[model samples]
Target: MAHTKASNTPSPRTIIPTPVNSTADFAAQQRNMSADNASQGSGVKLKKEIGLLDGVAIIVGVIVGAGIFVSPKGVLLYSGSIGQSLIVWILCGILSMVGALCYAELGTMIPKSGGDYAYINVAFGPLPAFLYLWVALLVIIPTGNAITALTFAQYLLQPFWPSCDAPVEAVQLLAAALTSLLTVINCYNVRWVTRVTDVFTGTKIFALLVIVAVGIWYLCAGHTDHWNEPMRGTFTAPGLIALAFYNGLFSYAGWNYLNFVTEELKDPYRNLPRAICISMPVVTLIYVITNVAYFTVLTPEEILSSDAVAVTFGDKMLGFMSWLMPFFVACSTFGSLNGSIFASSRLFFVGARNGHLPAAISLINVHCLTPVPSLIFLCVITLILLFIKDVYTLINYVSYVEALFTTLSVSGLLWLRHTQPKTERPIRVSLALPIIFLITCLFLVISSVFQSPIEVGIGTAIIISGIPVYYLTIHRPVEWLRNLSQSFNLWCSKFFICMPNQEKFD
Candidate 1:
């Protein structure tokens, strides 16, 4: 009897599902299963596979783009003092790190894919979440991508045309083409996309590091003429210092890109938090050192007056390598474009999935397991932005709204801390940290409001436009108020009413 145990096992193919429920339900089930199957087929067994290195690469790649190349001049113009400008950079780095820490906690707790959208939705409800998504999709991501792409194209073209005179239309077209090509490459394979990002990010970091080292050596070799200049009167003013700090903060953007891919990051609860913490300090160090080098080799007056500080620095360091600086700048901007495209498409995909955007955009390719529709949508929008005449103006307008939403997102951290105190937290920062972050973000938002009223008006119009579209596409006119009330009530309860029980006291 013991020897009679059966050796036969049913083949996986032989096990077919016995259907139950209406055709619609069955179809829905099949669609989900197919999506799951596609994910499996791509050998993407863990969305959480991204490690510390990938996280660092994303943070650095996003932060070190055209901002550093173009921003130093602005910072110098605003600060008018090398020492004061360096201090502004340091303060900005610290503020960014604080905000990043707050975000790290939220990201780990949610462990979802959408980054700020998910956090805002959970804490503030659908309307705010939708607005955040709308602003990001329509203004921030597209304009940001265009700026980076345009910067890349400009730098690449600079070497060929040493005169630095080129047709604006030609640069715009080239930028658009570059963005579209990168979007296609990313849509094809996630692994290859990551590899390309790694290469570009590495190249930019190496170039910057070399520039820093050369500047140090040159300073040691009697290049101190720029270091002992009298402090400029403009830099002595507090208002100018504030402006430089804001500019420095803008250059340090992308501290939060890693949070967008939480679902794909392995051990997000641990790795995501650690990645942000580690990357912030590393980037801050790089930025500080780079500024010191610039100040050592070139005066504030020189930097404020120069269009290409990095190129000037390179020429000073090694005459021959001056030709190579533009290539490095191109690589830096390209990496930033790639990172922005990668992170931002996920926001669209999540919005579409949640019925906040057009459902068609939620489509996932069965073979590649990528959100092809969202990717294409992003590409088209970026192309449109490329036609806009001024990248700086676009960035300013988009950043104002982005800073507003970011302020909202940071407020969500405080709201969640009070409301969901009993909920398990994967990462925890000190209470003071969030308070500092909220204050910093609120300051930035207020500053933005005062700095560019017209741009803020345009950004508000873009957000309000979404409400009508939402009603037409998803909600009935009669029930619109009812749904809105329900959403408001939910936000209040989750963010205000639902305090933690006694055992979990903060």
Candidate 2:
């Protein structure tokens, strides 16, 4: 036994094998491994299935809302010419199309959800991404829904109770109730929400078509004299073009909403690009034709002075049926709110899933497969904002921020082009398109800032305040301070925070 314990380790040895058999077995094993990896990758790539029609429906549902219903009066007031205002709409549509195209490339490249937040993060990193998400949750989405809800309640109540002396509180409560109800519907089932939205979107489009058809018919009958009246402002002039562009920009607000649901959209690479390209031109045509109809029936002065622009146009041609205008407006607003609720909640969900937001927001309702917590949180905030008497103030404040963020998001396309050159981009922008998009966005941002310097300043303050909160929530004390310092410097250099060289917290 002692002698046998001499070697605990064994000597190396080689054994011969059938070379052909071993080679065949090795090749078979490799093929099996490759097949397994492919299957696993496909599983990871799976996403919610939505088609091009759904994408188009979502875009139209969100875009054709209170803007068209309420903004015509404001644009008429600004431009003082129906024809010139229509031109503005056209210009905005074109600019929006350019932006949408840029986003399409980004959306296809990333093919993730979360809309602007995703694009911004991929290009600039997390801080700027979180800032946009913070602003969107606190300001843009809530305020927008509140404004629409209030408008919806106002018009719906106005027609039914024209002579009823209701308290302001009653109207506010009604608006909040309507907003809450729609929120519930949307939070329950995606399919149900989409179906409701489709109906509302279709109705709104049909109503607009009817108005245009009737107005044109009346003009052909020589019932109106405003068709040949000179435009309110000179064509192609800077002032006129600027005014028109603003109007068009308002109409183009939701053109990029489809990008928000990239994960839910089936075949996003094909559907998203097609949906945006198709929807913008169609909406532009609708706006131009509708404005032409309006001008054919009423003078620029009349449109400018009218409190309810669509109703006035309807009244001139449709008489008693004009009351339907408010109802249609309500439907349009409801659809818009639903679309926003659906898209914006996904922003929070994605942010949370990626650790940018709290875990609570990312919690999915297993039963409904919807982000119920986020949806309910948004509803509460919107309900509170519904009490604000004036919609214009909210728009003035939120629109500026939205335009700024949108500009930043579009500018991200340039960064991605350099950083992720080999990344899969199912959609591609032309060489000059990004340049044109950037220029247009800059103009819009400048115009918005000049138009509402005070509101823009307030918005800036609100957005910047998020940095501290973000640190508090996500980082340890010392790390938080360091991150804040770094973020301040980064934002100063990139976003023109307070000074050109020195980064200040304020």
Strongest candidate by lDDT: 1
Worst lDDT run of 10 residues, candidate 2, spans: 497-506
Clashing pairs in 2: 50-266, 81-232, 88-244
Highest-scoring model, TM-score = 1
Per-residue lDDT of 363-396 in model 1, one digit per residue for the tens?
4543355566678889999898888776557666
Where is the poorest 10-residue window by lDDT in model 1?
Answer: 497-506
Question: What is the clash tally of candidate 1?
Answer: 4
lDDT of 1: 0.74
lDDT of 2 by residue, 1-506 (tens): 02235764221111111122332453353345335435544211213656787788899889998888667766666666666676677777888888889889989888777889999988898889989988988778888888777777777787757676446777789888888888788667778778877888898898789878987787788866664555736455444455456666776688888877788888788889899988889988888788778778777777777766787777777778878887888888888888888887778767865667644455444335566656776788888788766655766666667878888988889877887788777788895988888887777667656665787788899899989977776554366554554443333222211111010111
Which ranges of candidate 1 are over 4 A from the true structure? Answer: 1-46, 229-231, 234-239, 477-506
